[model samples]
Target: MLFAAGCLAILLGITHSILGEVLVFKRLRENSIIPNLTGHKFNLRQIRILWVSWHLVTLFGWALGILLFLLADVNNAPATLITQLKQVIAIAMCGGATLVLLGTKAKHPGWIVLLSIAILVWFT
Candidate 1:
C-alpha cells in the first residue's frame, strides 16, 4: 500500500509540474486569460513574479510528495505515526480538491477515486 501510494505521489508530482510549469504558466504569459478573468491588467514584472511563485509552490508540493514517499518506507513506531498523519493530511487534501472541483462543476471523479483508495490504504 505504501509503495502504491508512493508511486501515485510521484506520478502526481510529475503531472502537476507539467501542468503548472509548462502548460498553465506558458498560456498565462502568452494569452489574455488573466486580464479577461480579473478585468485588470498586470505589468510584465508582476506576471513574471506570479509565474515564478506559482512554479515555486508547485515544486514545494512535489517535494512534499517525495517526502511522503520516503517517510512511508520507514519501519519504526514514530515513523508509523508520522505515516498515518501524512495519510490523514493526504485524505483531507484529496477530499478538499474533490469537493472544490465538483462544486465548480468540473470533472472530479479521479480525485474521488483517489480519496477512496487512500482511505482504504490508510486503514490497511
Candidate 2:
C-alpha cells in the first residue's frame, strides 16, 4: 500500500505538471491571463514566476514520493528516522490536500489523491 501510494504520488506529479502546463499555463499565456504582480513592465517576469511556482509543487511531491519509495524498502532503517519521515510525509500530504481543496474550492480532483496518500502514510 505504501509503495502504491508512492507510485500514485509520482504519477500525480507527472500528470499535474504536464497537464497543467498544457491545459492551464498554456491557455493562460495564450489568453493573456498574466497577473500584474509588479508594474506592467515586468509582466513576463511575473508569469515566469507563477510558472515556476506551479512546478515547484510538483517537484516537492516527487521528492516525497521518492522518500516513500525508499521507506518502503529499507527493512533495517532506523525506527526514529522512519517515524520522522512518515510524520513529515503525512503532514505534508494533508497540508497539500488542504491547500488544493481550499484554493480550488473543492473543484480540483488533486485533493482526493493527496488526501488518500496522507491517509495511507498515516496508517502504514
Which one is best on lDDT?
2
RMSD of 2: 9.4
Candidate 1 weakest ten by summed lDDT: 30-39
Error of 1 at 36 (Å): 19
Model 2 misplaced stretches (Cα beyond 4 Å)? 27-42, 74-76, 79-124
Candidate 2 residue lDDT tens string, 19-104: 87787576445444332234444554555555555765886787688777767875746986677788778877887777666544
Q: What is the lDDT of residue 4 in candidate 1?
A: 69
Which residue runs does candidate 1 get wrong by more than 4 Å? 27-40, 75-124
Clashes of 2: 0
